[model samples]
Target: MRSVLVTGGAGFIGANLVLELQNRYPDAWIVVVDDFRSGHFSNLEGFRGDCIASNVAELRLSERFRDGTFDAIFHLASITDTTDHDQLRQVRDNVESFRMLLNWASRDQTPVVYASSAATYGKAQSVMTEATDASPQNVYAFSKVQLDNLARYYHQQHPAWKIVGLRYFNVYGPREAHKGHASSMIFQLFQQMAAGKRPRIFTDGEQRRDFVYVKDVVAATLAALMAPDSRIYNIGSGASASFNQIVAGLNKALGTQLEPDYFENPYPFYQNFTEADISLARKELEYQPAFDLDRGIHDYVDWLQKERSS
Candidate 1:
């Protein structure tokens, strides 16, 4: 059986990816490394795999597994809380961990697929694309920019290495309850309306986002392994959805007619609009998002209700 390593396997997207990995590669030896700084144990409730509860940077990978042991390495571990403004801590944790992993994996030439972020695009005047220059507004996005740079540098030095970076758009799906405040607006709105509270949004509720479902993100991450070359690709729904539409979707899903509570936009750096240009991902990764806003909202709400009941 092949071995696969997933860092931050207990986190939101990580947990979903891990569960899917379990189903797809039943016989594969899967190991998870998470510090639980942001990840919760409940996220991995049904996951059947070896888990190392430690920081990725501190983890002694060589002592635990030999070089060439991991057939594929999915590096998802990072300080995901974008609100975190501590420049030094955020950059160190996010960038250094990947650096250590990449340096070690480079020896055996392990195929590494890592999570980048759409936040790197910041407030783009037009649709976000890989060709567009990055304008990071926060430390978290800046760290991801550094990750992309690192990946590109390594690829340049070793042309044969398969290191792929996926710039995830606004993702939402199962096993994300642990994120709490950082959870996707879809999940958060469902919760608010489920409790008979009006869904809240920024002023006018017209701010749009490319909310890609978590399953689609997983598919893109897996497809990255098949990339013909080491490169970065955007993983998103390829379409934008307004917050007002989200409220409407939630109302229909919950069988309620709660309107939105529009409040003033507080953060000056908030992105008013975001739409991913997924043409590169389409051509390179052969990725096609199966879940649109309506379908994804329905599917996610159904799962969320079941989780609450269970």
Candidate 2:
């Protein structure tokens, strides 16, 4: 691959993927397209690639680059905030932006590995799989469902194009601080414990989530580029960890014991549990998670401390 494009390059997962791309493909000419809506420039501090501050829907791909310029595209841009209730804005930004990218990429038949979400499972507690129908409790998840729909439609239209969508589970790791309230529970809990305050959790703190590290998410995403056909796969740790366990992990990582302040969950649409069935991704992409909850927590905490001192 000579040229590469990452849409949400300054975002949490996007930033991690961008840095990895630089390390693995030193000679590749990389370009980033981001509007900074939910992304941060600090996340791309060490990135040695060109960045275009523009939305995917508004960016004129043809004017900037001719056909076949981008060897591969990693599309991660979207309205990531799950709590935001603006249905029109969420659907428009997330869905239309993907539509524009697909229309442009069709010219060269460029391979696109885009971000999907585990939230599509809604309240379903069963292990998430690609074949399961999307329930989409929120507009953000609804928009992602639309993106997958678009992927399917475009795949049928252009049979040879490689379009892979990765249904990312609760991804948590470095470069996610900018997400604020939408950031993972692990990061939020770590912050609270580091500050000598009790971590807060909903109710009894038994709600479990499949917290896959961002590094693993990036690995599965990059592997999708070589997929033989257009399809979607679930990317996760294949195990669910309860909120109570998260507090325990944070306590161990920070070397400070802090009990969680339990409160009732205000959101009715909240998912009580999520665990991905990653067997398909393992068989198809040959992807394996290198970090589990404890390892990921320690690594992320160390990174956070380093960033604080730096």
Candidate 3:
């Protein structure tokens, strides 16, 4: 824990993790690596670490990470946009960049905790677990699945290194202002409400999603440093909340009772429901989600209002 690396450290979850890392390990020499593809430098307004503004694939080219430089690496950089259409770029950037980082980690024998996704579960509605079959429906999800597969291959090749992957569910919270259209529905709804507009929803807004707050996601991610083993685990609330509930929560938080305007969902490949079965994560990582939908919404709205003022 003396030296840590957080790729995509300016992203929503990574930025929050950076803050938490500083708070927890005051003496750790933290380094943030990002290409600014979707991450915002403003997100690291108070970050104290060194930054390498490059893709993980270019880490070696940039001549960083010589050897035993990073005690642990939080690999959150990837093609996170689920709607990305370029299949080749998605695989190249997400999977190849990760392969580069995995090679670096293997060479250094450093522990790595990387970001996986719920997208691997695709249309599966049953409780999501580590054992669930991967059914990726898009190129982005496919890239994540490939990353997981690569990690498994490398883990078998290098048995002693800790290479854990966290399959994050619908994470939403602070430092996500730059996600734009890719931001979560919670942030999108809050923005519409703050702008004195009705929240927009597709259809009946009954489609459920397990929206785990960014704080909880960061905690679960960091827990892998002390986790029992290096394996993929779901980091989520283990509870599903509908879009209707999200609108309701926002209304209560913003003190604006605005009914949602229903519209048809444009995308054909949409997950109707997702609820993570976090029992194994709970037992293994000792990770528990503290912010329910309502609580997380409250915290998010508070930050939103402050952002407006600042």
Candidate 2 regions exceeding 4 Å error are none
The top-ranked prediction according to lDDT is 2
> What is candidate 3's TM-score against the reference?
0.97
> What's the C-alpha lDDT at position 48 in model 1?
84
Candidate 2 structure, TM-score to reference? 0.98
Q: Encode model 1's per-residue lDDT on 1-310: one tens digit a residue.
A: 3789999999999998998899999998899999999999998888889999998888777876764488999999999988989999999999999999998898889999999999999999779888879999999999999999999999999999999999999999998888888889898888889999988899899899999999998889888898998989988999999999999988988999998899998787887888999999899889999999999999999998998898
RMSD, each candidate, Å? 1.0, 0.9, 1.2
Return whichever of 1 and 3 wins on TM-score. 1
TM-score of each: 0.98, 0.98, 0.97
Indicate whether candidate 1 or candidate 3 has the larger lDDT.
1
1 versus 2: better lDDT goes to: 2
Residue ranges of candidate 3 with Cα displaced over 4 Å: none
Global lDDT of each model?
A: 0.91, 0.92, 0.89
Error of 2 at 243 (Å): 0.3
Candidate 1 lDDT at 161 equals 94
RMSD of 2: 0.9
- Which residue ranges in model 1 land beyond 4 Å of their true spot? none
Instruction: Report model 1's TM-score to 2 decimal places.
Output: 0.98
Candidate 3 lDDT over residue span 1-310, tens digit each:
7999999998888999999999999999999989999999999987888998998876683256544478888999987888988999899989988888887667677788999999999999688888999999999999999989998999889888789999999999998879989899899999998898999999999999999999999889888888766699999999999999999999999899999999999999999999999988899889988999999999989988888898
